[model samples]
Target: MRANEGRESAIRAYTRYETLTGHVWRCACRARMLESEQRTGLVVYVDVSNRLQPPLPSGYFGNAAIGVTATSCAGDVVSKPVGYAASIVRRAIDMVTDEYVWSYIEHLKNQEDLSKFQDVVACGNPNIAVASWMRLPMYGIDFGWGKEVFAGPGSMSIDGDSVILSSSTGDGSLIVAICLEAIHMDSFKKHFYGGII
Candidate 1:
């Protein structure tokens, strides 16, 4: 879309995740009618599948993602152009590296039991977690029958959990799926589309 809009030359060439995450966070904040100064956050999962120096072997497969949080006041999220939030998201992401990943693992090791660990991301009302699977092998997943026609998370079981998936046709379109209270969906939809610039 940015290419079509001829905006690649813009100072900030936003990635798809940054674009959608910022837009969604703003719309969600407005939909919830959060107070102007209330702190709002977005937790985005970053894949470290290949961040290590030696890297995991080519066939390795497991949970290799970590979440990074970006925060700002609700007023900033709602009042600024999407690029403002995108910059925050980009900064958070840019901080991650092989060194950070190693340190994060050591931090995780300190937890007595991994099952009870929570990473300080506020879960329900004001924070959102976005997991992008756009670059994963979602469409190529096949079984005995055939390649699946569509592949996506069965549901967003919690409030503010979102997923970004590539369209099955791989036409460069994306599927953004998020869950919010029924009462807020209408307002959020309006803001999400209307604020597109």
Candidate 2:
């Protein structure tokens, strides 16, 4: 497949994985919650900069991105097929307009406690955050010597967070770095790669 084709496939797969994982986490939370308590929904945060039209300036160095979240109940997400989850993700992403971006900035500006603006995972919520670094020129960076053989995130111990990075071979492939507790890693692995092969 061409690079774009591979990239699209990777995006779809990653989104599906994220949706499934978010559902799993939500279900886990429900299991732990009191019987009278309401089930906390799952929120999946997807990076929305690439979906923006008339993209930001090429050399713009500031944070030019916002996250769009797809939320659903544990039963709805875990019981439904992957296509259902994918559609939720697609709609959430499609809702990120230029106006929405500006509104998000205003919302941030209005916040009284910046410290409370924790990421989905850090907020003690049943949520997941996914960031893609697939198109970055990881292998093309050469200070003085030749290109580096391998490139990936500096650390990978953040639970409920996943980062998608380009393969080091410069091939049209991706490497998804996921961090989960030891007990849940096996089940996550099963759901992550079960039908993909």
Candidate 3:
């Protein structure tokens, strides 16, 4: 934690994902130079495997996650410390449970067009959609030939789209990758990983 007032001095605990996403959200919003009052959303994918009544079997290989958003104004992101965004992210994730999952499914069922479902959290500037694969067993995946050079959620086509993946070497490090506009890339790079041009 670099020196930034006494924001992080409080006795508070945050998961690695929460902390990173919170920081990234602040950076992304700052990079985009969004208005102070504009709504900014940090979309997160929450895993609902264990939240189910009967957990999915280990062999039940498939996506079991739901996308949630932790949103605040651009000013809030820039003004508040990392803990603010982290707390928002943590709250968003914690709000998802079995009932929430079921309600989400019902909402999906009621939707006339599923394509527009992501319009709320996933959009252009001031918004980011983060997908995390850190919990998945990815490093050991072999498609019958050999170890993969990289395993992730594929390329991020839109600005503010990002992915969090475990290191391929199984070294217990994370790869936090994001896609931003060319104009904003430098600023985002500076804020995301400082001291780098």
Candidate 4:
């Protein structure tokens, strides 16, 4: 039909269709496909830099307590078994340790300190901060009712792999969200939602 379509058709006929992620596949035409492009699985981590009123103490606010909001890329949040999702959120929060946060904060503080001293001689920043491994899981966001409007596992940051999720308003609600890279997202969805035959 169109020039690009004709080229794509030729590629499809000759090029192999490799399993890229989950239900998502990739043709030889494209070497790589990012998760954001395919809308398969995503993890977003946003540092809520907004200071709360009354200046919360570091220890009190450091608790991984937050809200969660699950929405499709279309921005319509599905309403079904939200409480179940809430539990998953709580589990994610309970899993993280305070030491990790403190270590990160201290590391950043050191960076700031180094920046201020203009003529500091070089003895490499010997600050070795080790944060234990943390895993973000997304195998539980299942909506058997008429297929979720827009279903996504979760997203997070690269350094900490922090599963960033919006705050949810409900009892026993947790604000943590487990985000995955595009690769993990596809695999996880298949285990939960099955393959697209």
Identify the leading candidate in terms of TM-score: 1
C-alpha TM-score for every candidate: 0.86, 0.68, 0.84, 0.21
lDDT of each: 0.82, 0.56, 0.81, 0.27
Better of 1 and 2 by TM-score: 1
* lDDT for each residue of candidate 3 in 122-194, tens digit (9 for 90 to 100): 7568789877878778777679988788678776778889988888766788888888899998898788776
- Over 4 Å off, model 1: 1-12, 118-121, 146-149
Compared with the true structure, what per-residue lDDT tens digits does model 1 show for residues 26-60?
Answer: 88999999999999889988878787777878888
* Residue range 64-153, candidate 4, lDDT tens digits: 332212222211111212222223223333333445445645765779366555542221111001111122332345666643443233
Highest lDDT scorer: 1
Clashes of 4: 17
Clashing pairs in 3: none
Candidate 2 local Cα displacement, residue 171, angstroms? 3.1
Ranking by TM-score: 1, 3, 2, 4
Candidate with more favorable, higher lDDT: 1 or 3: 1
**Cα RMSDs of all predictions?**
3.0, 6.4, 3.4, 19.7
At residue 114, candidate 3 shows an lDDT of 90
